[model samples]
Target: MTLQFSGWLPGGPTRPTTARRCELAGGEGAVVRYDERADSLDFAPDTGPHPHGLAVVTARDGHWCLTNLHAEDTYFVENMESGGEFVKVAPRRRDIPIPFELARLILPVPRGAGMVKVFGPEPHYLAPSALSGSAANWPRLDEDCMYFRVLVALCEPQLRGCPPGAVPTVAEVIERLGDGRPAYRISRAAVNHHIDYLAMHKLRVGEWAGAADGKRSYWKREAVVAMALRSGLVGEQHLRMLPSRRVTARQGPGPSRLPAPPPRSRR
Candidate 1:
């Protein structure tokens, strides 16, 4: 599992221009300080010492905790996956559990406000028997199908620890699903068809979100991604299906493993 943090350093008058990122494995801890003498990630000025400092964060298998080391400011961890849900870590609080699978750590800084993008690990699944018989009536998706490949491609950016706003376009989805296979080809129409099939037939997003065809392509992509990620339909494990060249070409590191999906079972 991985825990990544992104912070902004002072750069200009209006907004912080420089960004500093740090990564830690499970069981690792680091101090987010802002001074010339500070260690780990230092969001100090381009020159001398700055009083802006004091925050500690630790990582675990699936979640992380933040300690507000500053004596005055209370830190806020906003759950980016959810709609504006946030939790506050009181001043001097230690190891407050953060429940967001994807989050933003907000800090009051010399600039108007400093933000850190926090990426948590994929969620853990409950025991198979816990809800074994209850899923019979639910909409079913086959991971080995071509349509499923399109869904995974659409959600790749977020699944690979990028922001949720990075939903791929239809052309992008076609490129991702191409993967250089023999005689494998997908067109824009084919991709849109797959997405439409997913939104209306498989997931039944129309009941509340209305028809997918009426909305713009951007809205349809976002709706599909939101529903898929929220329901744990596509995740980090499925990212292997994406081509490695394109996968690592993304901002952060891709998953360490890229094994092909198990051979599709004969129906």
Candidate 2:
């Protein structure tokens, strides 16, 4: 892939609220579906690659759920991108990481699919500590807050798929930071110090947005992606590239416009 580092300006919201991809027929093609009501997309396989294969369906909720063979793994959908007949397919992984303040995952849609939904609501979450005090009481403020926010953000909408909250939750953070360690005892003051250190050096929070209309407004993740591109924080080629038609143009090769080479001294 050609990795370009051009920055993108923050643009107003675009259509298709949620994008999704599903592995079809054993990873051949994916069916991408966006739902305005759910503010998300549903991906399924279009063909059966094997008599039995695994299909992954990812939603806007930031979770990937698996579909079994006996289940309805394949589906038919019309292409919004192309005014063609409906096709059967599954979603494919473009594996693009769209950077926000942090990296947000971006899934690719099939070539023919277009905006399926518009103007969907943003994802919501309840504070993690609202459920339990165990991890909530952890002393390290920054780590605790970041971990709490990420876990809560991932789990809140999928409560039915998850278990009841636990104080010291068995979340990914615990495993990543090493579970059952006394590091959580690090004091709030120390956590603040680390945050300040990061701010002074590496981590930056830019382009603040004010809340209006009784709605909590924050910078769109795309803004951060644009900033990263502009600053060369991440390569532009990493952004999901949609298929496009080639522009027709006529041009001819031209000789270099340069000063004539210096005459060689003859012996």
lDDT of every model, 2 decimals:
0.69, 0.30
Worst 10 residues of 2 by lDDT: 1-10
Error of 1 at 63 (Å): 7.5
Counting only residues 3 or more apart in sequence or on different chains, how many pairs clash (N, Cα, C under 3 Å) in candidate 1? 0
Per lDDT, the best of the predicted structures is 1
TM-score, structure 2 vs. true: 0.19
Write one digit per residue (lDDT tens) for candidate 2, span 1-267.
011111111242344433343322212333333343654445444444524333323232322222223243343332222211233444442222211211111222232222222111123567987775555421222433443233222222122212212112224323323323466433434433433333223333232313222252222222222233234333323222211224558888889899999999999
Best by TM-score: 1
lDDT of 2: 0.30
